[model samples]
Target chain A: GESVGLHLPTLSVQEGDNSIINCAYSNSASDYFIWYKQESGKGPQFIIDIRSNMDKRQGQRVTVLLNKTVKHLSLQIAATQPGDSAVYFCAEKGANLSNNDMRFGAGTRLTVKP
Target chain B: DAGITQSPRYKITETGRQVTLMCHQTWSHSYMFWYRQDLGHGLRLIYYSAAADITDKGEVSDGYVVSRSKTENFPLTLESATRSQTSVYFCASKWQMNTEAFFGQGTRLTVV
Candidate 1:
């Protein structure tokens, strides 16, 4: 069965510190991965994404790292801010190119302390 | 106005009532998806369409129906709404499977 899951359900970090969220995927055929952030009462927003061919991809304030060997994915946020406090989800898509093949993981709730 | 959008951002329906949620995207994305977001369960795929007139069931599509007659529109219907089906529904679109998906402001559907 193909599934994506997070390593932690909650994380607390001090503002201006860094935060790391982790996810594990079971499908070896998954070739693309994405990280999304969801604020309260809002839909999840795309944060970053990486292809299986690449180990890492950097965005403005976030970076996505892919470890294909362990089927693990991680999102790193630098200088965590209050705006960064939200539930973050990791999604994966297989090589089949079917939208049905995309899957999302239980999110990690990030709390940033002032 | 240039991205995906979902209609009736909030809805309250009684059980056994049929409700349809509308989704429209301006990008004409090749892939469209419907997902239900519940506490602890994250976002579970309900249905998806690869293109116009091409639809497929997703992990949690049993209680829902979807149709994509136009490339820019995909609508999900709940023939008989259930209490368990009360969850925030999100519509997303992507130009390709390998690209990042853009989600519309979710529609908070509550089945009373």
Candidate 2:
């Protein structure tokens, strides 16, 4: 079955260092891809997104890179902060209006050491 | 006060019990979705609605039911809860086809 997956279950980084999380998906028919940040006990928060037509997109301090050929996705955060410590997830949107609105990766726990 | 919200932030129920999780959004978005997050598993889509009265099942919809009587609400019902149903559920909505989804605080359900 086609699904989204993460490269690592957890990641540790220095407070001021950069952080990168990776994900791989199998569906090429997806409409777009999104990265979400989830704090403990809270819902996933939308961080950034990239459309299928584009290979990369950037937000305030975040960036999402998509590699269609390998069906891979990645989220890069510049200057990791203590508040950036959370579970990050990558998801690929499903077709237009079918059941699969988005398929998510298991998630990577990003721990920033202060 | 204009974002998505889920009721009973947390819940505990026994196996075989019927439970319904509520999700409400004030944006009047055209799309709403329900997803469950479990340990070691990616968030799984249970159901989604393109519009009021239009609903469809997702990858994991076997034991779940959903309805959207109004554009602002999409509730998920578990006919008979099982231990495996213990997980965090999130409700989200997007304004259009190509947009970021706003998520609720999420409901942590524990089936004992």
Candidate 3:
């Protein structure tokens, strides 16, 4: 039963402050990881991604850090805004083309208090 | 650009009923995927297609079926709807492996 899981089910942060969400996966062979932001009643939006080879990757005001040794993944947002309040998910890609094997974490509900 | 879109934004059905969720993408990406999002769970891949006429199942594919007749379309079918199938379905497309997936608005299906 290999799966990806989040460290926190919900996180509350002050507006303009930084926020960090964490995830841990059980699959050791997973080579790719991605962070997705899902607004209420909407589909998950791609935020950032990092491969197993690299420890960190940065995007516009966002960063994804991967720790292959511990099978941990994290997404860091530079400035927490009201619009950033959403459920963030972390997904890990499996080795094969099998879709079911690519697991997704339960997600962390990020709340930015404005 | 309407990168991806799912039809029947919401659906309601009874047990044993057959339902199909439609997903359309304008990007003509090489990879298309179907995922389900539940209350506590994030997005779980149900199926994916590398190209037209090629489809594969994901982790939670038991009660679902998918087909890609054309590159721009990938649809997921629930042969027999159940209470367990009540969730939001999302369709995503990616240009290549390990790339960011563009997601659709999602289809919320409720089985009574």
Q: Scoring each candidate complex against the real one, what DockQ results?
A: 0.73, 0.69, 0.66
RMSD for each of the candidates: 1.5, 1.7, 1.7
* Candidate 1 error regions (>4 Å): A95-100
Model 2 over residues B32-88: C-alpha lDDT tens digits?
999998888868889999999999988789899999999999999999999989999
Each model's fraction of native contacts: 0.76, 0.76, 0.78
Standalone chain B TM-score for every prediction: 0.98, 0.97, 0.97
Stretches of candidate 3 above 4 Å error?
A96-101
Over A13-108, each residue of candidate 3 has an lDDT whose tens digit, in order, gives 999999999999988888888898989888888898888999999999898989889989999999888999999999888764354335788989
Model 3 chain B worst lDDT run, 10 consecutive residues: B37-46
Docking class of 2: medium
Tens-place lDDT per residue, model 1, A2-93, is 77999999999999999999999988889889899999988889898898999999999899999999999999999999999999999998
Q: What are the per-residue Cα lDDT tens digits for candidate 1 across B1-43?
A: 7999999999999999999999999998999999999888899
Per-model TM-score versus the true fold: 0.95, 0.94, 0.94
* Highest DockQ against the true fold, candidate: 1
lDDT of 2 at A13: 99
- Whole-model lDDT per candidate: 0.91, 0.90, 0.88
TM-score of chain A of each: 0.95, 0.94, 0.94
Query: Per model, how many backbone clashes are there?
Result: 0, 0, 3
Q: Which ten residues in a row have the lowest lDDT in candidate 3 chain A?
A: A94-103
